[model samples]
Target chain A: MKAKVIVKLKEGVLDPQGQAIQQLLAQRGYSQIADVRVGKLVEFELENVTPIEGEAMLAEIADKLLANPIIESYRIESQ
Target chain B: MSIAVITFPGSNCDRDCLHVLQNVIGAPARFVFHKETDLGDCTGVLVPGGFSYGDYLRAGALAKISPIMPAIHRFADAGGPVLGICNGFQILCEVGLLPGALMLNRNLRFISRWVDLRVENSDTLFTRHLWQDQIVRMPIAHAEGNFTVEPETIAKIVAKQQIVFKYAGPVREDSPDGNPNGSTLSIAGIVNEAGNVMGMMPHPDRASEAILGSTDGIPIFRAFAEAAQEKSRLEYSY
Candidate 1:
């Protein structure tokens, strides 16, 4: 089994990197960019794990390694 | 007073922190490697500044997940004092030890300069030696020091008096214009809810010595030492 975790800054939190990228795109004449937010995608490969177990493992990873709960949130999906 | 300074692979300020704590403060402070599991008999832990792991993914993204952090977290949860400075601060935030997040400078530039900070709350062990509203000069060098959180969370932080330091003077009057980095509310540092852990973007260790152009950082260490002493006394009173 494989799991993918998508981490993003929580709402109302400032995304400076996203804003910088947006600015760069605008400068490059890609003005159609209405919004841009940067996030991280982490993939995990596991064997003999159920979806629930995978989710629990991903939560552990998010809390202990992948995401900083103070400002980032994560979603886990199994494949 | 034994102090442990955690040193990640790319940490450049571990020696500086060790020097200040050992020489100036006369404390037994040692540099602990990131891969080290033992914290020894240290009473307090100091996460010094510098680009840990070259700040590959994020300012402190990788360093926070190092093998030693779980031990650091256990130490902190046991009511131990932990001070995170600059890159250390970012690691704390990245590890969820502190609230809020540090984003890239609003100007999108790497900032390296000395700025004045106003002491907001001096009740913590980290700031007890300083008077309220006391101004101190410290150097900040980071590309992502701009702090941000939800408005409700900001209000909660203010209500809990978690905010410890804010930029002083007109230099950081406005987020984007004044300070080299555009920090929200011009926040320089803050303590965790438990008050035992603190994370700040400015390098207080850098300002501890007179030869470093400023000695304003002395009171912070003094306060921590005094607080530790007081706590020890209280614990033994029983």
Candidate 2:
């Protein structure tokens, strides 16, 4: 099994890199874009853990290390 | 009464911090590798600036899981002095030893230059010999040094006088209100609730010498040494 974790800055947190990218897009005639945000994705390889266990483990890993609760939020997907 | 300078793999300023603590400040200091289990006999811990763990995942994120972190947490829980500079600041925050998290600069550029900082609170272990609101010059070198926190946390830290240093430079387009990294309320350094653990983005170790362009950071190092001596004294007397 493989799991994916998406870590993104919270809504109110400033994302300067995203803004820079958005500006470039607008310059290239993508001006209709409303907003842009940056985030990280981490893939994990699981051994024998069931879906329930994998979800719990990934949440803990994302909460404790992968994503900072103060400024970032994380989502987990497993298959 | 020595300060333990914890060196991570990518830590570039470990030598500079050790030099300031051991040679310039004349305080006993030793190097403790990242793998060290215990902090040994050192009274205080110094987390110097550098690209620890290559700033992967985020600045200071990877280094938070280092083996030495548990020992650091124990020392901090006991109210021992822990100072984190630049990358150190990020690591401390990642470990929840500090209040806020550092994000990319507002302009998204790495800022490296001398910045004027007003000593917001002189009563912290890291600012003992400094005066409140006294402007001091120090070099700041980091991109993810912009400090951010929830709205509620800011009030709590301000009420506790946790803000130690605030950039006092003139307002610039890149750094609104003169904060080089656009930190909230222009904060450059802060202390934890216990006031024993401190984290600052500026590199005081780089500014502790006159020949290096400033001596304003010398007193700050002296304050840290003084705090270490006090900690050692308390241990021996009891």
Candidate 3:
């Protein structure tokens, strides 16, 4: 089994890296950029756990380690 | 007692911090590896800077859970002095020992230069030697140092005087110290609610010597050394 966690900076937190990329694209004639927010995807390989167990553990991992609640949020997708 | 300069894998500033403690401040210090579970006979904990865990996931995220961290927590719980500089600061925040999180610099660039910081709260054991609102300069080298916190938390930080230093004075855009990192309230350093732990983005250890261009960093280290020594003495006095 496998699992994934998508971590994103909170809605109002400044995403400077994303903004820089958005600006870079604008310079290359890519217009109509409303907003660019950056985030990270973490893929994990799970062993011998049912999908429910995997999701439960992933939630704890995301809450405790993968994402910092202060500035970021994480959503887990189990497969 | 000695200051335990924590060395996570890839920590580049551990030596600098050790130098400041052992040589400059005349305080005993030793290196404690991240894999170690005990902090040994140390009264002070110094979490130095560098790209720990290669800044993966987040700057200080992985290093926060290092084996040595639980000992640090125990030490901190006993009112021990724990100072985190640069990457160390991020680790403290990641571990929830301090409030706020450092995000990418607002300009999307790695800033490495001196920053003008005004001492905000001199009451902490970390900042006792410095006076309130005294402007000091220290080298800040980092990419993700723009500290942020929830809106409601800012009020508590201000009210409780958790903020220890703030970027202030005239900031020039064309100078070597140009480009502010956009930290909330311009905070450069902060102490926890108990004032036992402190975290700051700048390198005070790098500035502890006069020949390094400024002696302002001495007072900060000196204050912590004295405080840590006092705490150790208190523990043994019983």
Candidate 4:
């Protein structure tokens, strides 16, 4: 089975890379976009686990290693 | 009598740390590989800067879980002075030993330069030799040194006087050159609540000698050595 973790910076944390991308788009006449936030998607595979177990395991992984609770949050999904 | 400088893979400044601690500061020092479980009989632990684990996932993220970290934690828990410099600073935060996270610079550039750091708190073992508000020049080389913490945590940091160093001079006003990275409150360094573990973004080892353009970093090493000596004497005498 495959699992995914989407890690994103917390709401109040500043995202300079995202802001720069927003500016670059504006310069190219894409002005309608209000804001942009950048994040990461980590995909991995796990075996011998039920879907429910996979979800729980992914959550544990996300909490312990995939995401830094101080600045980033993560959501896990299984496939 | 000896300080242990842990070297993770890709750590470029470990040698420099050892050189400064052992030769320049005239204190016994040794290098301990990151994979080692023991810290030996070293009184102080120094985590030098570099792109540990290739800066994967995040700066200092992977190195935080290295095998030797638990031993370092145990040392710090026992009041051993642990100094983390640059990437080491990030690792301390990554491992949850220190508060906040080091984010990318506001301009998103890898900055390398000598900047003025105002000593914020001189009461700790790390800053005891320096007077509060004394400005010192230290070289900073990092792309992600912007320190950020929530407002509540920042309050505690301020109330406890944990801030050890801050970028001197005006940041928002006319002269914005002092703060190379957009660290919250221009924080360049901070100490833990117990004041034994310290994490700073600047590379003090790189500035330990006058040939390196500044000797301001010597006081930090000197203070640590003094405290380590005191701790050693207490442990062995009793």
- DockQ for all candidate structures vs. native: 0.52, 0.92, 0.87, 0.75
Give the alpha-carbon lDDT of every model. 0.82, 0.90, 0.88, 0.88
The CAPRI-style docking tier of model 1 reads: medium
For model 4, the stretches where C-alpha displacement exceeds 4 angstroms are B169-177, B233-238
* Two-chain DockQ for model 3: 0.87
Measured by TM-score, the strongest candidate is 2
Candidate 4: residue A78 Cα off by (Å)? 0.7
Q: Can you write out model 2's per-residue Cα lDDT over B127-185, one digit (the tens) per residue?
A: 97898889999999999988999999999999999999999996667666788887999
Prediction RMSDs, each to the true structure: 3.2, 1.8, 2.2, 2.3
Over 4 Å off, model 1? A1-3, A44-56, A77-79, B169-179, B229-238
Residue range B1-238, candidate 4, lDDT tens digits: 6889999998999999999988888888899999999787888889899999999899988887799998888888788888999999999998877899899998899988778899999999999999989999888899999999999999999999999999885454433766778889989999999999999999889889988899999999989877777777246311
TM-score of each predicted structure versus truth:
0.86, 0.96, 0.95, 0.95
Worst 10 residues of 3 chain B by lDDT: B170-179
Clashing pairs in 3: none
Q: Is the docking of candidate 4 incorrect, acceptable, medium or high quality?
A: medium
Query: In candidate 1, what are the lDDT values of residues B1-238, reduced to their tens digit?
Result: 5678999999999999888887898776788899987676667788889999998867898987688888888777777788999999998888878888888787778888888899999899899888999989989888888887767788988989999999874455444345557666778899999899999998888899888899988888776655544444223211
The candidate that achieves the highest DockQ relative to the unseen native structure: 2
Clashing pairs in 4: none
User: Residue B23's C-alpha lDDT in candidate 1?
Assistant: 88
Docking quality level of the chain pair in candidate 2: high
Segments in model 2 whose C-alpha atoms lie over 4 Å from true places: B233-238
